[model samples]
Target: MTANENNTNGYLVGTTLERMLKAGHFAVTGELGSPQSAHGEEIRAKAALLKGYADGVNLTDNQTAIVRISSIAAGAILVQEGLEPIIQMTCRDRNRLAIQADLLGAYALGMRNLLCLTGDHQIFGNHPTAKHVFDIDSIQLVQMVADMRDKKVFQCGDEFKGIEPRFFVGAASAPLADPLDFRPYRLAKKINAGANFIQTQLVYDVPAFAKFMEKVREMGLHEKTSILVGVGPLKSAGMARYMKNNVPGIDVPDEIIDRMTAAGKGEPWFGKKNAEMTKEEKRARSKARREEGIQVCIDLIKELREIEGVAGVHIMAIEWEKAVKPIVEGAGLYPRPSV
Candidate 1:
């Protein structure tokens, strides 16, 4: 389908990310953190950094429960900036009525992609005392969005008077997450609920991820929805180790940690801790770790590309937008394909 093509029939998702996946282009997507204020320029500045590096940029919805600019509004800003934004919606705060209302507004603003999420609890955000309103879960949200687009009706079964939003709906996955044996089944549930694509949590252990993909292939979930493996540059050896030890479902390998530690070794003030380093030394040290992180991410993408059931890579450098370009280019996914 042409980029500008619009059809009421829903056969064509028509978003750049959808087109790339359809044409087997090995899509690249990135995360753009909406700032914690009503700043359109912040979104634009980040768009400039990511414009040519990704097929679609995801504008997170009050990520981490922190209040921020709405993801849909950020998506509109991105559209104005000549970049495609994937508006993210979470079930943590809104009811069905609010969710549908925002989606209608998002489509009117030229947003074409959506990622349904069960957002972080209010305890994780600034509003610890706020009430939780998970009127629906992520799976139900996907089904609702798909229904609005394809079935042309709201979750209440009310028909759209003129037009319903056409979104390439997506759902998140944590392949290595516990009840480890049930992850694939969970993915299947999302697909059965009408997710057009899947974006996963950050992946560090390629072999473990590949095993998860093996089950995905067996279940044929990959054929039903595009799977974008998540990747990101490690900021430091400590970060890598921390994730491996603390982050649930994230299994960071020893070799990667060793490599991250090695990347910082032999640098200026090698023996000095980051806290004790001079400002200039800290800068140099950070630059080295970031470079190594980018390389490691690139290598992961290459390995993932060769694996079955993997359609793309989702680069999640939320606060570190500058890393997106180098990571994409190094992975040979830059100069994003035109739909």
Candidate 2:
């Protein structure tokens, strides 16, 4: 009579990373950016490529309000490929009934992890013509999931004849958003709403993040919740600039920009130029970037982990999936768990 017995085949419910957080270990997770169109082959190829390197793949649901293949479809593909799938549930495109149906479908298909998001505005993405349904924000979505689990019923008023879902519920956070002082309050709200863990927007200011973690500890949330500091690899100077100037809800300090600028000016270490360098040079710089990224990553992870109540790390490499294993290894995380 375990709480998880209701889950589909007792597969690890909740995100693999969240399960790890609950178990008291630093966990690693990644995202699988869906293809722009119905290109299933391309999507499957991408997920297959990331299988061994990531503990779970978060299939974005119209991420940034961008219209793309559905997250459920992508989640199904990831599950079939032997990788854990985190079904990214956004309230932008569906009403409560649709949400319930989708969640049930995902569980039946073997998806366990759920990352609920409030979703981006439609105007920000390519699909301006699409209608949005933010009928429920992320907090309510978390509550809804909890209710379904505890009640063994769907929002659609249907009773389940079989197992209930044991979802490792997760929610998003942007530590740098709005008045800095208000972040802790927002986090408290999400936690109150049943968010088991959080994955933050890409963070650049380690000291600022450290301060935030301190506040989390003071609030006594450090041990009660798991916080994963998101990290995006800078593919080049331009990519770095784009993230700073264009990406919403991310703050990259002038110092980090200065470092990348300085690095850009230095001679290509190992006689490499741009992306066309020999495989060995490419490997070396990739290693060096991952090392550099991991150094910053480890610093934050160490500080974040030391926070009296903080649990594990979730490393997000974006399109640089190849670098994830190295970065995690570089950060000294061995035997990366499959779940």
Candidate 3:
């Protein structure tokens, strides 16, 4: 269908992200990490930085289980600044009651997009001693939120008195997660459970993701939902190696590592032994590798846009928020659509 035709159908025409995506615009969403302190200025600054470049900015919910300003508060801050915020809700820190209440509060705060997550374990954060409250997993959380929005009722089938939260529900997906063959089916379950859209884990190995998408297309899951493939800039060869070796469900091909290594060779410290290189020299090498990583992301986005079922690109420049504008422009996705 044509872009204009898709726009007129109007499944979700409220939030900028929903409008842009529904209008068949190649949508771009960026991630913003909430500060550990309740400094409202910091959140506003990040939101301002992403203003024109991204259709929406995802406010992480104590991402990695580390304590931070609440996603709902940060989202409210962004909304006040005229930026669209995707409030991420993780089940690691809250039970069903808190989750439902937060959803209601977020909607009242004018936040329209919700990204439900199953969150990292407490053991993975600074407060390992803290107890977890995984009363439900991500799938169940998505289902619950969908129920609240569509049925105007609680999980126990209790109806609401007045208004129900209107949210454009989203969920996370790790396409390269273990038992690769099952990843597609897992995604189908999320769709069945009521995910309106999906943002996947960072993707570096394109061919592997293509294979996964093939399975998804075979099942016609793509037609049932919108898929935003995750793309991010790698800082260095060392960082790439670290992610591949330590991070779960992330696949960084050997070629990308080699490319970063080759890019770093352009630095003055190329032939110098690691112990002999000065800190300045080391920093230059890291910068060169990061620049190369950005270029790689630009190319990846161009490639992903060609995939049949791929709906959009979620440019998660991680801590490098400034790089998003350049990457999006480089990939020719700039001049974001106006909703």
RMSD of each: 2.4, 4.1, 4.3
Best by TM-score: 1
Tens digits of per-residue lDDT, candidate 1, 228-294, equal: 9999899988999999998889999999988888886876677787589899998888888889988
Can you tell me which runs of candidate 3 are displaced by over 4 Å? 1-10, 278-280
Instruction: Provide TM-scores for the models.
Output: 0.96, 0.84, 0.94
Output the better candidate (1/2) by TM-score: 1
Candidates by lDDT, descending order:
1, 3, 2
Ranking by TM-score: 1, 3, 2
Residues 1-339, model 3: lDDT tens digits: 642221324455277787887778888999998888979999888887899999889999988888999999999999999988999999999999999998889988889899989999888888999989999999999999899877878888999876778788899999999988889999999999999889999999898899899999999999888899999998888889999999999979999898887886655688688799898998887778778999989988998888889999998876688788889889998888777
lDDT of 3: 0.88
Worst 10 residues of 3 by lDDT: 2-11
lDDT of each: 0.91, 0.73, 0.88
Residue 176, candidate 1: C-alpha displacement in angstroms: 0.9
TM-score of 2: 0.84
Q: How many pairs collide in each candidate, listed in order? A: 0, 5, 0
User: What's the lDDT of the predicted structure labeled candidate 2?
Assistant: 0.73
